[model samples]
Target: MIKNYIKLALKLMLRKKYYTALTLVGISFTIMIITVFASFVDQIIGANTPERNRSRMLLLDKVSIYRNGKSTDATPSVHFLQHLPKLESAETVSILKRNEFVSFLNGKTAGHVLQQTDENLWNIADFKFVEGKSYTTDDVKSGARVAVINEKTKEHFFNNEDAEGKSITIYGQAFKVIGVLKSAAAFSKLYGDVYVPYTTDMNLHTTEKAIEGTYSAIILSKSEDARKVRTELRSQMRKIGRNANGADSLKLYPFSSIEQFAKSSSSNDDEPEYGKTTIILLIVMVLFMLIPAISLINLNLSRIGERAEEIGVRKSFGATSGALVKQFIIENVIITLIGGLIGLGMSIYASKLLIQVINSFDPLFKMPTDTFIVSWPVFAFCLFSCLIFGLVSGAYPAWKMSRMNVIYALKGGNSL
Candidate 1:
């Protein structure tokens, strides 16, 4: 009996080929759009590292004073680096100074800036080495003119040749390339095409004798007790320096806190309106799925009306309403499951097309090479969503057809 229902469903679909094609296309297109956007958001948020550890901490100065009836733009001097209180739980401290606009190897261009950092900088963040090794404590102490170039810089300068051990003149000083870093995600916040020894680069560019006293410091904590340490650090800084009103003027942030700050402070130009955009997309997709599902339900109702005499014969021969509803549901599930498989194939092709478009924008913008292929979780999600839509849409018509009056249905005068 179940087999007969499937046969009838297939025959019905084939009889209305245009409607069946439209339904399949609608489901496939909606799934494609959702999957592509999901992959994109995953890539953006998971830019520097894996999604699970998407948190980082940032410290700032909280002091502000009013002058001439307006708030003054007072911030902690960059020289505050020298006064950073040593926390027992801190692993390493890295000093950074950005956007100095110094000259590179060629004298013709002099607009690039060095992102200065200490030797253990890579340990704090996941920095992949493509060539040579990262800086060491000795390099910092000796004020070595060594630098690390990112993949983009390598391609730009050296082209196809090896970038390591190459001497590049920056700000009229020659610096050796001791390392080359792999390309980072385009949307990453911690982006630098070139990294130089903090103290060394500072000495060459400025007349200052010691840069450790003036650079911004990042203190890395070894454990998850970041919040406690943050509180302690802020208290320590406040104890060392206070405003006129005796209020704490130091700011502290934990690893998780920084990410939230970044999200809120992000520019609205290209940012995804996660809440409204996702809700709107889901609503539109559901509506797209509904239209065809409604058509299928109407088709089923018409077929059941034509088979009213047969349904009456079955009821007279002892078929229960429950049995009839079950048969119809099973038939719809089979059709939906078949459509889902096709939709899965469509999703794969769509993912590939999306990857191509992204890569075409820039060579470094390739889809994640590791685990780039679709996973079982994605497949399962698509299948589950498809089944739910199928079941809900098919239920009403099946239930209505099953409740027909047997004697009246047998008389066959549009009983439904």
Candidate 2:
């Protein structure tokens, strides 16, 4: 029965060539827009390179402090770093600093985003290395000027040649590139074109403690431990993380990858708006599909009208309304699946092209790396969404038209 439904669906679709073309095009355009947007959001919130421990990790990126009525906002400081509350579930914690480094490349100035880190970062992040290895504990302890660079940095400066074991000059200091990373996801605490040891930055070696600095932290823990971690962090900070240099107030929040993106722009003084962000995304997706869904419903009704005589004949032969509804929904599903596949293919292609284009202007504006992964779960999500559109648009109209009296339908009276 299902096989017959598919054949009939295809026949009906081909019979109205223009209508099928228009419906497929509309669905493809709508799904394409949704997929592109969702893919980018996925890059920020989904598991990716370096931060593959996304669900098991929390990032502390920004801090807010108030002292003598002066408000300052920046990355967490050495003071907060030193006083960081011990998270009971923490497996490892890493401290990182980001800086813009200017280097002379082919007699022209090139800027790179650099990450300075302790050895712990390497433990939490599994950076894919194309050449050499990451810095060791000894190198960071001895303040060795060693660096790890991304492929884009390698290509920009060394013309895609071997970068490991070669010195790259930044701010009159030559740091030997120790490792070369494959393409990595950007726009995170771990994001950078070049990476080096934090000990080499002598400015951070200051004996005096401060409230704000260019330092951020990432803590790896069990997925279920996030609530406890956040709760303890708030409690511990209020008790001991303050009172530095007369700054009686300080604010910071720890977030998972998805929460981090959602709360990226919210004020640190309050709890992150996780619920609000989720609601907004749901609303946006519903609104985006609303128009396409209405069009599909109307199109289904029109198609039913054109086949009123056929429906009447089938009804007279004792065809059940349920059977007719199921058949129409199946037909709708087939059409929606085709549109979905086309949209997804276009999204994957666009993402690849965008990656190449984004690399040319990277560190200035970092694009999410390697978006639109074709995993079973992702594909299933697309399929499920397609099914929803198919059922919603086709089921009711199919049922109503299928239930029309044989006499009324045969007379070409389309009143539903």
Q: Pick the candidate with the highest lDDT.
A: 2
Candidate 2 lDDT by residue in tens digits, 183-220: 56655557788889988876785743776777888878
Model 2, runs deviating above 4 Å = 66-72, 83-85, 107-110, 205-208, 241-243, 262-269, 352-376, 411-416
lDDT of 1 by residue, 237-266 (tens): 567554423333444433333333333544
TM-score, prediction 2? 0.89
TM-score of 1: 0.60
- Spell out the clash pairs found in candidate 2: none
What TM-scores do the predictions have? 0.60, 0.89
The per-model lDDT (C-alpha) reads 0.61, 0.76
The Cα error of candidate 2 at residue 416, in Å, is 4.3
Candidate maximizing TM-score: 2
